[model samples]
Target: MDSGAGTAVGEMFDEMPQEKRARIDAGGEDPPESSWAGLHADALGVVLRFLPCLADRARVRAVCRQWRDAARGRGVAPPLPLLVLPRFRFASLTPGGVLSAARRAWMPPGLDAGNACCVGSSDAWVVGAGQAGGECFIVNAFSHEVRRLPHLGTYDCSLRKVALSASPESAPDWIAVAFMIRWSRPELALWRPGMRSWRVCHHALFAGHIDIAFYQGKLYMLWKFTPCLFAFELGDDEHGVTISRMKDCFIEKLLPTTLGSTHELSCNMVEWHGRLLLIIRYYGGYQARHRVKVKVFVMDLSTNPSVLTEIHSFGSDCIFIGSGGCKSFPAGQHGGVEGDLIYFGPDHYNPHDAFVYSMRDGRTGPIFKPLPCVTHASERNLGFPVWLFPKE
Candidate 1:
């Protein structure tokens, strides 16, 4: 017999004495090889950018040691800006649901006083305050970062009406916060990303019935009294402030509006089609009788005088404001890129459910569950939802 055959025969003879013969299977298995050998960080970063949700990206890190290292190395690249949605206080949305990127942490006790309100979010950081007179805090859930702004001062009577936004064109990044002061004046504050404190600019014109929005590189203040928009640059220079009054800019002034009035209707507070928008919830039809009816409008700024164009209205029995519409406790209001998505807290639902509506995909997906301590009830109250993005 050949040497190989002889070895095999010898092995069989060894077991033959015990009345058992071992059999060799030539194609039974293949030797192991390292799966991580050729992995690249750049490729991993591309995968993370479109992960749909943050939790899934987190799962990739927990897979194994090699995967964790690869993911960590890839994560160092600047991540695309994430939109934040705040959860309400006291009640939980779901028992063990996933937490959205915004609700990752709780407001500090010092800042979470009973009257706290989350005004809005910018670039993954949230701008909130304790009602009108309460202190303002910018909370970054991801970095576990928190910074308190200067006291809003008694000038702002109705804190609920304040507007918080970041300059859309600033390089290093800065937050532009504007608050209405009832009869006196409005306060415009600037919070630079790395700055230790906020700077305030008091203006009497902005105190009138108006809405504030940061667009391009200027702060656009919509005056409901005169019904005009004032564009102010984000700097201390006096020449930076420019006032462009719209002639006959009042088209739908008679239409019922909420929080503040805008001729154009949009998703809560977002302008979808390059125009300010408002969503009017009408009730009457069978679908609207029980649930809320939605009407959307877009503003025509190209016209010599701005005008609101009614786009479309949908009556749905599905999107109830407080009922089975969402699984999480609803907090403040909801806003997003026009026609992109609509997000809100299901304040009355369990802590686990996050309600999101996407215009592009035409579907809503649950986001994340809050960590136990993060969802606990506190003196701080939660308001509506706002999209936070890094300064562009």
Candidate 2:
């Protein structure tokens, strides 16, 4: 932890409401002989539902022996994903998309808010770097743990995206992959824990915008506006990290379509239930207000030349897509409806309205009303909103 960041966090804590500060200090203490301690575990579970944030629930568990036992037996349902706003503040959205009060997150020391922006997130960890250069680190949002990384060192291009093979909890085996745009082509880089520097790989075929995902120990890359797919096998030896390109795969014929008269096409890839999914997003109109659309396809790499099939139904899975990374979660597990629904939230365009799109019916509508706190005046300074799952 950086000393400055620690001090800042302590100051935030000190400024908390007196009632909240009391709860933190007393650990929600109650009379030892209070009858509330005799409440049944099932009833306690019902009470816990009202506290959505994990940190809030954790404090409730400390209220009494019975509550603690109930919390241990049946943990609180996972809270709705949080939106990471600027200055380390987290904003929550109701299932209906209404924005709630924002809470400040503990910032690690030396993380300069003015120059740093989060590039990627996975398993509750965020990867952020300084815009001017020399600052790169991984912050475990849940635990406020910080692990510094080697500087990118004049890479000559801005990092466009990043993906982690596994959670920081996985330790030594975890791998970090970063994608950069250089000379109108995608450049891939890899960094593992304890490595003094990142390994850059310049592939001839990595042209245009690209999305990368790690599935079953291999890195998969998909270029936008094209049906071609590339796979790379990653390894380590005395020579450090190695990336070897595998055979190329192609999707069925589907030419890129223009968004009205303009030519803006973006695609992203995600792994769900051992399968790879590709999503293409189309945007149209001017900067003030634009129309957005999406197309989804699933790829089967086991076939001789690989097969890309248009998917109509997602079945029991739902996908959360944003600039951070596209992720699939079991709908039932996350209190979401199953079968081909795509959820879109705030992104680079500063569209604070959230929507749910149905592939089954080909209809799209607003899922949540615009958040009150996210106004036009504050939009420019805000970071891209992403779906953040709670730490297990």
- Best candidate per TM-score, number? 2
TM-score of each: 0.51, 0.76
Model 2 vs. true fold: TM:
0.76
Task: Give the per-residue lDDT of model 1 (tens digit) for 213-253.
Answer: 65545556554333344556555433232232323345456
The number of clashing residue pairs in model 1 is 40
Best by lDDT: 2
Candidates in order: C-alpha RMSD to true structure: 17.2, 5.5
